[model samples]
Every structure is written in structure tokens, then in C-alpha cells.
Target: MADFGEILRSIGEFGLFQKVILFALCFPNAILPFQFASVFFIQSDPERHCNTDWILRADPDLSTGEQLNLTLPREEDGSFSRCRMFVPVDWNISDIREHRLNETTGCRDRWVYTNSLYEATIVTDFDLVCDQANLLEVAQTVLMAGILIGCLLFGPFAESFGRKRAAQVPVVVMVIFTATTGLCPNFYLYLASQFMVGIGYGGYRLNGVILATEWIGVSRRALGACGTQLFGAVGQIILASMIYFVRDWRLAQLLTAAPLAVVVVYIWFVPESARWLLDRGRTEEAKQLITKVAAINKRPVSDSLLEKIVVKETEKKGGIIILIQSSVLRKYFFTIILAWFSLNITYYCLSFNVGNFGLNIFLTQAMFGLTELPAHILCIWLLEALGRQVSIMSTLLIGGLLCLLILAVPQGNAAAVTALATSGRFFANWAGSICNVYVQELFPTSVRQTASGLGSIASRAGGLLAPLLNMLAMYHSSIPTIVFGSLTLISGALCILLPETRRRELPDSTDEAEANR
Candidate 1:
């Protein structure tokens, strides 16, 4: 039996079969938000009153409860039409007040509720005053934890079982929960469902990178890896449109979950990665898979093709200890982690707060989702043509600058600020997607998934802080925006300190990575 390295060398690395298999994984990234976006429905405070800061400043005599019916212009456009901004009319004020005292300050958290409120509507039978916001926070936070665990675990599975099985496993797990998340009855049940979803998310995210990079030639790996993100944006679009038609969160969750059943079909249509098969010491299997892929792609694989291939192996196995133990890799690790954290915190904060920006929640989310299409295309284009580090740094800087710009605009200029924030969201999303490719490339192949997972865990750590930022933004005015903006700038600056990975073969070992740095 050939060793895994010899087996991989026997089949030309980064071949057509890997690309097709990776693309199958990309499909889910384009549409898994059905359950993930359930947070929007689950924590909604329909009874939420419009922020009365402007009103309170103008008329100090109005009581908080008395201000519920106050008429306000919907936007800075100064339309003659007036809208009453409040949570759903059915909420019991007394219960809300009690929740405010115990859970939120001043009965606020309306903005935080916007992204996650949908989960409440679908999973829980509770009325308007339920403290679903906290539940959602828990869900979002724990999901990241699952993502952390998945990222750490998938590489071993992929190494032992082969990339196809490891990558496909997430699709199966996601299929199971994506179908069942809507059925969760209690808050805890929903939280568990999200954690499961996060595990799948982590698996898919990592698998997409590994498979795409491994399948494509080194020259095209960045493009192919980043292409997965375009699917994530597509997923956002599909989810946004689905939400428009399926107003009920449960149905929306079901609709999103149902599409993933196509993963089983992949077993028939998709071939196992030749490179991965080789890595696991299965030369014959790798050779067979490669031949079939080459045939399907109409590329002739000559008899000498296997003889010409070579995979040089080094004695390196990266674990948690090695990651923290190496100085250069450790710096890259921490920097990527902080960058991931900053990105997710602001990204989710902006996304979840769409409903609070004086528009229909679905409409706002749709606009945001649609914006990502162009954002991603622009990102993919610029990242390749320009250097990765420059693009990543510039994007983060632009995002942070836009957020700071929002503060200079007056309260009456909320529309301008909202529009600016939307632009910032676009930049941040682009930066984030690009960073996924960028961070993974910085590490050696042997520990690629491990390093990626560590960064992902860090990113999730930032995600865990997002709801808190949303909650803070609700109370501290421009503080949340300012803080997130500052974080982005700091991350961008740190990113500048990192080396570029453009047009370079992935480092095969830590020594290779440090030498390049």
C-alpha cells in the first residue's frame, strides 16, 4: 500500500474532480441561512417603541408609555406620511417593562431583536413579551462554539477518512438540522439546533477552502476559494427572497433546510478528491477517481500522467500546541483571530440591525443581501488583480471609516448614516470573505485546517460579541458603531503587518511559512 503522500503524488494534485466536488459544497454556503437567519424572527420585539431620544429632547413631559403613539417621519426624506414606531401592538407593556428591568435596560433591545426575532416566531409559542432576545444571543454565541469545535475536528476526519467524506459529512449533518430547527419547541432546543448548524457551518466553510484550493491549480486557488464566498452571498439572496414569500419563520427554515437534501445526490455525481485520496495512501482509488474526472472534463490523462506526478512529504503534524508554540505562526494566528472577531462583530451587528433602520425588515435585509452580490464580485476581482494584503487592509479601513462618518451626521440625518452603514456593511462583508481565503493560505498545508479553525473560532468569538454590540448600540447612541469601526481599523492595521500570499504555492511546512514571512 502506498503511503498517503505517494498515493497523492501518483495522481496529479489539484485536478478536475476536486473542483466539481468543492462546487457541490459551495451550493450549501449559498443557501443555509434559512435556519441561521431564524434569529431575525425569534427575538423580534414587535411591541418595540421607536427610540424617543429626539422626542424626549423636544418634549420632556411625555411619559415613556404615553409616547407609544407618537407620530414620526419614517426617514430623513421628510415624507408627509407619519408612522408609529413601536413593538407589535399585542405585547403586554407590564411584562415588557419587567423584561427590560431584568434583561434589557429601559425596555430597549428592539434593534438586537430585529435579526433574531424570527426564531422566536417559529420555534417558541411564547407571546410578544417573551425574552427571546437572550435566547437568541445564547444561540448565536453557542453556534460559534460549535463552529470552533467543527473546525478543529474536521481536518483529522478529512486526513483519516478522506476529504470527500469529511466535507460531505457536514452536508448530511446540516440537512438533518436544517430540516428540524423549525420544530424546536423550547429556547434551549433552538439553541442546540443552532449549535449543530454552526458545527456544519464550520465544517462546510473549512471544507470549501480545502477542496477548492486543492482541486484548482495553485494559480487559480485564490479565485476558486473566494468563489465559495460568492455562493454565501447567493445563499443570502435566496434566503432574503424566500423570507419575502414565506413570512412565517418556520416555513422559511423548512424551505432552506429542504434544498440541502441534494447532498446525497452529490454522492452519485461528485467524485472523491484525487489529491485527498492520495494523501490517505489509496493510490488505486486516487488514480481511478482522477481518470474519471479527467475523462468527464474531456482532458486526456496519459498513462505516464501518474508516473510524472510527485508529492514531497515533510515530517510535520500540527496540533494545538504547535500552533501556540511557534512564534511566527502564533502571531499570524492571533492577528487572524482578532481580525475575524472584529469582522463578525460588526458584520452581524449591521446585518441584525437592518430592521431597526426605519424600513420593512424583509426589505432592508433583502437590500443588504443583494448588495453582497456586487460586493463579492468586486472583492474577487480586486483581490487577484491587486495584492491580497492591500485589498484586505483597504477594505477594512473603508468599512471603519464609513462607520465613523456616520457619527458626524446629525440625528435628523439617520438616512444618510444608514446608507453609509450599508456601504460599510458591503465593505466589511467583502473583507470578511476575502479574509477567509487569505487566512487559510497563510498557514502550511499540514496544519491548514487547524489554523483555519483557530481563526474561525476567533471569528466566532467576535460573533459572540455582536449581540452585545447591538444591545449597546441601542443604548449608547453611536458608541457601538464607533467601537466596531475602531476594531476594524485596528484589524486592518494589523493586517498590514502580515505578509502577502499571492501567486505563491501554499507553504508545506511552518519553516516554509516563516521563511516566506
Candidate 2:
């Protein structure tokens, strides 16, 4: 049998190069989801209400006019007006389109340029837009649903196939599909691409977390895991800056997809996780990889120590079910589910609703991504110094409270309200990042991927609810803020139930973790 203590110590140790590769592998796609979430700014047709069914009803005149209204918001001469109705395809005439005059109609037929009004007044005299809003919503929901399945599927695959192969494959897949999302001819094609993108995203995210944790020392695992996400913040900033330059959603998506090329180059530089190899009984292979890693890290390898650290199967057998069947782990999983859900909802809500912020959509996105740099850096600093529970709880609580306060702000100062809301988002995101790091530490290697996967799925579920919340908020003034605030607050309370893992060594199995308590 392997000396579990020695193995734990060895697994905890990592050097600078390993850290860099892990960071690079995990960083580029950080804001890919942001691209999807941020699409609300450009995708929502505020003026057109052409129903897909109506267009398909074989009504050439209605379909023709619907396409024109959808195009108007993108045209240089077209203008946006607000909508008074709350129907799914109804475009708010004042808030939906650009502020350009319809010179052709002498600015008299704003309804013609507006999607919903164009359908209602000019086309069918009723809703005619092809139910595009529902189609888009279904697309987003299905994509997230795929994320749930993909994360679960990756656990066994990452364990069975080895972390390096599992981690690298998804990067290529994500790049291809994410890029294609920009070229989608219509809603159906976009939906399919989103599903594939979600799958790749789930696999890469889980594997990256596993690889980072496996490479680092237990003393530094939280730092590595949390810091890995900082690269995501960097990714967000890159995407944001790119969006500012590109403006168009299709081009912006292409820019987001471009990072896959850099990740491919890393195939030559990055190595498989040594811990994963040892655990899977590939001692010789593990040693060979370790030698290369040690050389790159400029560290000397200790053969005897390395042999002592190789994990060997013991008489006691545990499987995936143990993750949920174990008492303490069950509690840990449930609490994290709540926190993850809360985090996903608010994070996306804040990002997606930038259209209502009154700032230019591109500028708002750029600012939102930039805010994470400070938030993540601050999280990294505080997590190490203050411990996970306190840092996470405080950040969540403060952020949730701030979100609620935004509701009381007087109307018409959209810019000021948005600025405050963004500030609240900064703090909320920092807290949420802390939670991601904290939950990973709470589980053992046997179920580490499983736990992270479940948490991610839960987070995506929260994302599933976001668009609905957004639609509601669009109609009811205080719905989004109140709901998001309440969810965050509840998550903050649930966070208190989790045991703190700060400055403690990682437990190797569910048995060890439960026993430690």
C-alpha cells in the first residue's frame, strides 16, 4: 500500500512552471460564457415582433417586413424606441432600437422600424415575429442543460483517460464550436452550436480545476484553484476589450473563439498531471512525467520519495456513490449547490442586464470585465489571509445587500444606477469566486471532480433561470434585484454551514475528510 501521508505531501508540492501552464490552460475561455450572457445587448430585437410561426405560416409580406425591422436596429440610419407591452416578442419601442430617424417614412412610422410594433401595426396587425425570443431562450436553456450532463460525464472520463488528454481535447472542441456560434444563420443553428459549446466548456472547466489542484501543494491548493480563476477574470477583460473594439456580436464571438489557437500551442509545453498518473497505477509513467516537470521547475527529484508517494489500492474500496452517500459530504454538496446556484444567477444577471444600464453596451461590457481584475486580485489576497469562510460570507452578504439597495435609487439616472449595480457585481463576483475555491477544498480527490461538476451544473441551473428573471425584470421594475439579492443572501447563510479548510492539509478520501472532523 502507498504511504498516504507521503503521497499527500507530494501532491501538495508544485513549482512555478506547472502553475503557469495551469493558469494559461484555464485562462483563455474565462469569458466565453460572458459572450453568451452579454448577447442580450445585441440580440434582443426591441422593435420587431415577427413570430417565427407567422413567418413560416407562408405569409410572404409579414415575413418580409419582420426581417426588415430586425435589421433596422443594426442599420446606421435606424433608431431604437421603447416598447409598452411585455409579450415575449414585443419590442419596447423606446429602449429596444437605435435612436435614428426612419428617413424613408419621414420618421412617421417608428412602428415600421420597431420589431413588435412593425409586426403589430405594419405587418399582420398582430404578433408576427417568429417566436425568436422563445427560440433563443430554449437555445440558452438547452445549452446549460448540456453543461449539466457534460460535467457529470467528464468525471469518469478524466479519471479513466488521464487528466492531460481529457483537459486538452475540450479546448480544441470549445474553440471550434464557440467560433461557429457567431456564424449561426438563425436561432436553430445557434442553439445547436450552444449545446456543443456547453459540452466542451464543462469538460475544460472541470479538467482545469482538477489539474490545477493536482499539481499544487495542499498548503497552496486554494491559492492555485482561486488564482486559476483570476486568469478567467483576465479572459473576461480580454473579451470585454475585444467586444469594445468589435461591437458586433458575431465578430465579438469570433474574437472569443480565437484563443483556442494559443491553447493549442500549449500542447508542446504542458504536461499531464503527475498525481493523476500515480493514482491510476502508472508509476513508471508518473515518474517519467515528474522528471520532466521537475526539470522545468528547476527542482531535483527524489526517487525514493517519489516511489513512496505512488498511490496503491488499499483493501477499503469507495466509489462515486460515496460522494453523495457519505453524511458530511452530502451536506457539503447541498450547501455548495445553493451557493453555486446563487452565484451563477447574480453573476449572469448583472452581466446580461447591461443593456438596461444606460451606458453603451460595449462600454458596459468592457467595464464589467475590467471590474473583475480588481475583484479577483482582492479575492486572492484576502482568501489566503482571512480564510475561506469569512472571506466568502462577507463578500456575498455585502454584495447581496448592495443589490437590494439599487432598487431604491430614483429612476431616470440610469447611468448612476448602473454604476452602482456594477459595483455591487464586483463584490458579488469576488465572493462567488471565493466559494468556487472553497467547495473544491471540501471534497477528496476521488470525488473532487464529481463535486466540482455538480456545483457547476447547479450554477448552470441558476443560469437557466436568469433569462426568465431578466424578462420579469424588464416588465416589473424590482424583480431581478430583489430575487438575486434574496438568493445571494440565502447562499450566504448556507455558506456558514460549511467547515473552513483554511491552512489545513487536504484529506485524500471521503473517509479521511469525514474522519478529520
Candidate 3:
């Protein structure tokens, strides 16, 4: 009997219908940044200080410049501080002049934004500054925490329910939550909305890729799966442009969510996976979809050909426990999770570090998104050249080592260090995309989405840690770089133990997965 991929080949692997659906699905891939990484702009503290209205009232005749100088405290670098101000003292000009040396305190009454970039954001609207600064951090933590649960929740659903149904449910919830997030009246509600978005993160990460992978043949599977990541990059560029035009986080967010809500209807247009249908014993539905595919590919298929389609064993195990008990698949499971966790951690750390790159945040952000294409292209080539396990290991090790290179450079060379850092980001981005393809190949159809969901949950654990690393400046500025770099290095080395799935067909069951051993 022909293997599943061979049956696909007989009909034509990648046809017009497959190409169109892949492009359609790429929209959700683009929406990823708006939820995950857009926090860079939304929660930006910006240059700010205590509202200076009281100072103006105290000295009615004083100029705007003089009032600012009197009320706001300047840091040692001569830039006005964002979080500090002087006491509302009734001091005279001599005492006020000496106020530069006076003791400082956190902002009182309310803070004012000194930044011209964003007119307003979730940060400024709710005063997420000074004592309240952790609101944004907490919001992110809640979101990651949601993702951690979402993966476990959604992974099993993809297996028990059909792929098309699993993919649809989270997106509808994502649309509602994301749209409402813009309208959230308080930071707590905003965090609540973020957690909802995180649920969709795991769902989309698992089912979306599997939906694409299960359809395409083995020869194009890596390209098919890794290629969606380029849309994620495209979304980043689109988001950067949206921020530039709108300059208001809520409005920009609404704009992003609105488009997604409109596109939810398109999800119905995509077909359920034929392979998944066959596995479920819905052979008639599978035959019809296969006939549709063959018709699109201009291949002739006889009724006998449809009847001859075979599954060696239709009965299968459920849940993640099957993976845990099986020694052969277990090695791939644990190592891939570590690599994904490190990838997510470092990618965001570099991405959020855009302000330090000496380039405008928009330009740096666009460049970061632009890197996704060539990086994915390089990953696809590497999958072909070095094979899957080697490619995964090489990208992970190279990315990790590059991150460590940042420590060797002197702090004075900001531009050079930024270049080195972006290079590290490039490799980490490549590694993360490749892992998406690699992990899907490591499991069988019965448990593919479940395994992928578990992987996403593990990776998002990195997402949870990434925000805390941003706060590392309070302890030591270099600590984040050192920590993130070390993680990737360790994850890369762990790749040595993962079996390669390069140019290999999707295993149909647990027994077939072990046969790769």
C-alpha cells in the first residue's frame, strides 16, 4: 500500500487550492505580534514626570521652562526622570534653585508623559508608572500564564475534535477578547483580556501549523510549515506601520483586532484535513476531499484508488501520557520544549531591546520583521542540506553563541553591540521557526496537535520569564543577556539527542514513530 505522502504525490502534492489556503491562514500568523510583542509600544514608560500643574500654580508668572525645571528631577545624565519629582514645597527661588540637590520622591497627584511618540497607551491611560509600573509586567505574566494553560487545554481538543473545528474555536474567542482589550477601562481588565488572547496563542500555534502540515506532502512540508513564520514577520512590519500612523495604542489595537474579526468568516472556507478524516474512520469525507484535491491538481482518481487508501491501525492512544511513556518520542519532546522556551525568551528580549539599537524604534522593528523571511529561507535550505536534527541543533547553537557575544563587546560600542544582538535575534528567529516544523514531524497523526500544544506551553513558559528579564536592569544590566544566552546554548546542546526527521514522512502512529529509532 502507498504511504499517505505517496497517495498525496499521486494526486499532486501542492496544488492551487493548497496555496490559496496557506496564504489565507497567514493572516492569523501576522496577528501574533499584536498580542505577543506589541507590548513594547503599549506599555512603554516613555520620558515623563510628576504632573507640573501645581508648580505652575505656585509660580503663576514663571515660564513653562522654569516650572518644569523646578518641579521635575533630572537624572545624573541630565535627562528628566520619568518617575521622580520634588515635594510640593513652598520654597522661594533660591531654595527652588537649590532643589536640584533636594531629595526626590515618586510621582504625586499624577504623572505626565514627556514623549511625543505616543499620545496615549494602556500605560499612560491608567498611570502604569512608578509604583504602578508592574501592571504591564503583571498583564504580560497573566497572558503567558494563560498560554501555559491554553496549550494543555487546546492540544487535546485538536486530537479529539477535528482540526478545522479546533482551529476555529480559539480564533473566535481571540477576536472577541482582542477587540474588548482596547476598550478595557482599567489595567486589571486589560490583563484579563490579555490572558484571553494568550489562549488563542496556544490554539493557533498548535492547530494552524498542523492544519498546514497535514495537507502538504513530505517534500514541501518543511517549506509549508516554516513558511508561515514569514507571515508572522510580515505582521510585525504591518504592526509597526500601524503604530506610526495611529500613534495611539488603543486605536492601533482596535485596528488590528477589527481585521481579524472580519477574517474569521474565511476560516469556514478551508477544508478539514483529509488525513485527519481518514484517521477518524470518516473515509467517505476523506474520499470526497481527496477527490476535490485530485480535481484541483488535474489528476484522475478511480473509485478503487479511494477504496484502497489504508490505515495500518485505526485505534490509537490519547493524551500526552502516551508521549511520556514512549522512550523514543520522549527525547524529542523534552529537547524541543527547551529549545522553544529559549527561542521565545531570546527573540523577545532582542525585539524589545529595539530602543537601545541607536535606530528609530520603527526602523529597528521593521528590520526585525524583515529578517524573518531570509531567516526562514535559510532555515528551509538548512533543513534540506544539514537535515532536520542537524539544522535544529546548528541554529540553536549558533543563536545561543551569538547572544553570548554581546558580553564581549565594550558598552561604549552601542551600534556594534546592536548589530551583534540583531544577528543573535536573526538566528533565534530561524531556530524557533524550524522547531515548529521539526516538532510536528516528530509525532504521529493521532497525537500531533497534542504534542505540539505541549511544546507551545513549554515555549510560552519562556514568554512568562521574558518580562522579568526586562526588569533585570534593577539588579545588573548585563544579566538578561547572560541568562538568555546561556539558555539557548544549553537548549542547542540538548538537540544532539533529538532524532532527525529530515525528508521523512509523517509517522501514522506511535509504533511508526518508534520505528524511526
Candidate 4:
């Protein structure tokens, strides 16, 4: 058997062929932010009040101000009550003004939104306010649940099938269901579509990174992984721009799904993992791919060199059981799970609640998206310099501490809060991008997808919990921050146990991965 790394070197690693495939695989990452972070804009709470128009029946010429003043109750701050209106009365305007209606009731007809930042959103479209407001959170949770399910189903599927197939199927699913999400007639249908979209999202995310990483040399593996994330950051910026201009949620969603159609067509041209083919004893297929890659990269390969490619007969088929059965693998598996879970919770908590920072939503979101660009750039350097373990530990620790620091900032200091949150997001984004590369390096080829998938399940679980945790603000404003901060700190501390994988050969089997430390 020959070393695959040496074979990759001969074929011009990180050359034209690898660059094209990596770029093609990474393109979909740009769209994933539309799926993951669009919720913040699409579910935004617009300014609204009960339809006081019923009072118009009694006095048709009354001005907008007069109608609100007469028919709607005001909170202590003197804003018109969003969910309550006075009972309609038959009395004339003068009598009604003389003896104000004391009885209050929920909006009987519908809501009238005013000064809305968005032309429309799911909250407005579905009337998901007051009693139904919780449904908005449910929609996000449902999407995360779909992602979790996708990770579970696709992880093992990718392990059994091939990375190319796993990658292709999800793009189609995501495109279809994401468009369906826009066309959904009701909230239930919307939830269903979102769930399906999430499944596809999770599948494509896992496979695309693995496919790209498997194709690149170890020297450029960080580049390959972080490059995809850089595109993801660009996606976030694009999403912010899309939402700012196209405020209609349905139109924005349809537009978001449109680009993936291009991805679906182009992705089929990308090759399967040659490493995977050889590991599965498909030597002839691997040779053809290697030859093709060499030709594309303008490198020559000898038939003798190709003939040296062979599968190790000692390699065993792997599954989730392999992870559990081996103590070293088990330790890595659980630590990564916890780390992923914490990262997702902290990242999404800050991301989804971009509105609460008391700044312009569009600018704030754009700034948050911009923060990731430098964070990923820094992460590429950090992965190379500090090694994976220290990079992850330091980023998470610093990010978490920054989030906690917000608790000490005086309330109403929007600039201070925003500054702290953005800084934390910067580091959180750094840790997240590196973890994508780290997880792939930690496991062997046989169970890498499975391990990545299981880890994603934990991430989706954190995503699911993030919104629910944000709801904790209703009880105490500090609760969500404290919880998010504490989890991030704990996860950072746990990174102490992970082995540094810098400049290491990609492991091919369980024994190889165990021997990595």
C-alpha cells in the first residue's frame, strides 16, 4: 500500500483541480447563513397595536391619533397597548370621551402595525404576537430540530454511501424545501418546510466540509475548511443586504433558495473522495480520480505510482459503536460533542437576538456578519500557530468572558453592549470555524462523517435551546447571558483535553486515530 498523502502530493495538492472542487463545495456554505440566520430578520417583531378601527364606526372622521387615544389602553410608558383594545361602544364620540370605556379586551379583528422596519415578516404574516408569539420561537426550534435529525440521518448515510452522493442529495432537498418554506400557506406548513430545509442544511454542511478537506493536502486543510467559512461569512453579509432591501420574508426566502439551484447543477461535476474510495477497496475508481486530478492540475503521474495505491486489508468497517468501544475515541467524541453544543448555544444566542441590542437592525446584523470575516482570517493563522487545542480553548474562554462582561455594563449602554457582544461573536466565530477542521482531523476516515454528524446533532441541540434560553429574558434579563456565558467557559476549559493535530497525516483507520496522540 502507498501513502495517500504522497499520492496527493504527486497530483498537485491545492492546485487547480483541488481549488475548483473546494470552491464548488464551498459555494453552498454561502447560502447556509440565509437558512440559519435569516430567522432573525424574518421573524422580527414589528411595532403593532390592536385594530382600533372598530371605533371608526362610531366616528368616521376621527384622526388616527384620536382613534388610538380613545379606543386603546396605554402602558405605563404611554405607548398604545399592542394586544389590548377597549370594547366597542355605541355612544357618540363626546359621550365616550366624557366617560372613557374602562373594559379592555384582546384585538377582536386584527392587528395594525405601524412604523414597521420590515414590510412584512412571519410575525406579521401569521399574526404571531402576544399569545401566539411563542410560535415564532417554535419555528426556529423546529428548524434546529430538523438540523439535528439531518445530522443523525446523513452522518451514517454518508459513512455507508459516499461523500459525493451525500452532498448532492441534500442540496436538492434544501432547495426544494426552502422554496416551499416561502410558499407555505400556514405556520404549520411553514414549520414543516423549515424542518425539511434544516435536514438538507445539516447534510450539506457536514458533507461539503468533509469532501473539501479530504481533497486538500494537510498543509492547506485549514485553508480548505476556513475558506468555506469565509464564504459563509460573506453569506451572512449577503443575507443582511437581502433582508434590508427585500423586507418581505416570503420574497427573501424564495430568492435565498434560488442560488442553490445553481449549486445543485454544478455539484455533480465534483468527484467523490479518492481517499474514501481506496479505504473502501475501490482501488480502480481511486486511480481514475487521481489520474483525472493530476491531469487537471497539469502534473504527470506514472502508471507505477498509480498501481501502488492499495487498501489495507486489516482495516475494519466502522460505525458509531467503534467510537464507543474505544476509550480514546470515546473521550474525543464526548468532548467534541460538548464543545460543539456550547459553541452553538453561545453563537446563536448572540446572533438570533441581534435586535435586542438597541441599534439599527440592518446595520447591527451587517456588522455582526462583518465581524466573522476577520475572525475566520485570524482563525486560519491561529490554527497554524497556537495549534487546535489552544486556539479553541483561548477563543472560547475569551468569547465567553466577553459575553459575561456584558452583565456588568450599565443597562441602556447600547454602544458598550454592542461592542462587547461583537467582540465575543468575533472569538466565538473563530472557535467555530476551527472546530470544523479539528473534528475532521480527530477521527479516522472510516467514521469521520459519522463523528461529524453526531457532533452536529449536539450543535443543533444547542441551536434548539438557544431560542428557548433567550426566552429566559422574560423572567430575568441576565439569565440567558449568564447561562450562555457559563456554558462557553466550561466548553473552553474542556478543550484542554483535546490533542493537538497540527501537521499530522489524516488518519485512515481506528488504530491510526488512537495512535495520533
Candidate 4, position 395, lDDT: 90
Rank by TM-score (best first): 4, 3, 2, 1
- Candidate 3 wrong stretches, greater than 4 Å: 42-45, 52-62, 65-106, 310-313
- Measured against the true structure, the TM-scores of the candidates, in listed sequence, are 0.78, 0.80, 0.91, 0.95
lDDT (tens digit, per residue) of candidate 1 on 328-412: 8888888877887787778877876766676566666777778888888887678778878898889888888887887888766
Deviation (Å) of 9 in candidate 2? 6.5
Winning model by lDDT: 4
lDDT of 2: 0.65
User: Per-residue alpha-carbon lDDT of model 3 for 1-517, expressed as tens digits?
Assistant: 4467877887877888678767777678888787754476753556677786776555678887787787777889997777788777766666666645467777777777764577787778888777787777776678877777777788888788888877888788788888888889887788888888888877776788788878888888887888788888788888777787777777776887877886688887789988888888777788888889889888887767776875445745765788888888888788889899999899867876676666677777777788777898887788888888888788888888888898889877877787788789889989888888988888888878777888888888887888788778679878999999999999999888888788788998888888885
lDDT of each residue in 105-166, candidate 4, tens digit only: 99988898888778888888888998888888898889888888888888888877899999
> CA lDDT, every prediction?
0.67, 0.65, 0.80, 0.88
Model 3 weakest lDDT span, ten residues long? 36-45
Q: Is candidate 3 or candidate 4 better by TM-score?
A: 4
Q: Residue 340: error of model 1 in Å?
A: 1.8
Q: In model 1, how large is the Cα lDDT of residue 448?
A: 70
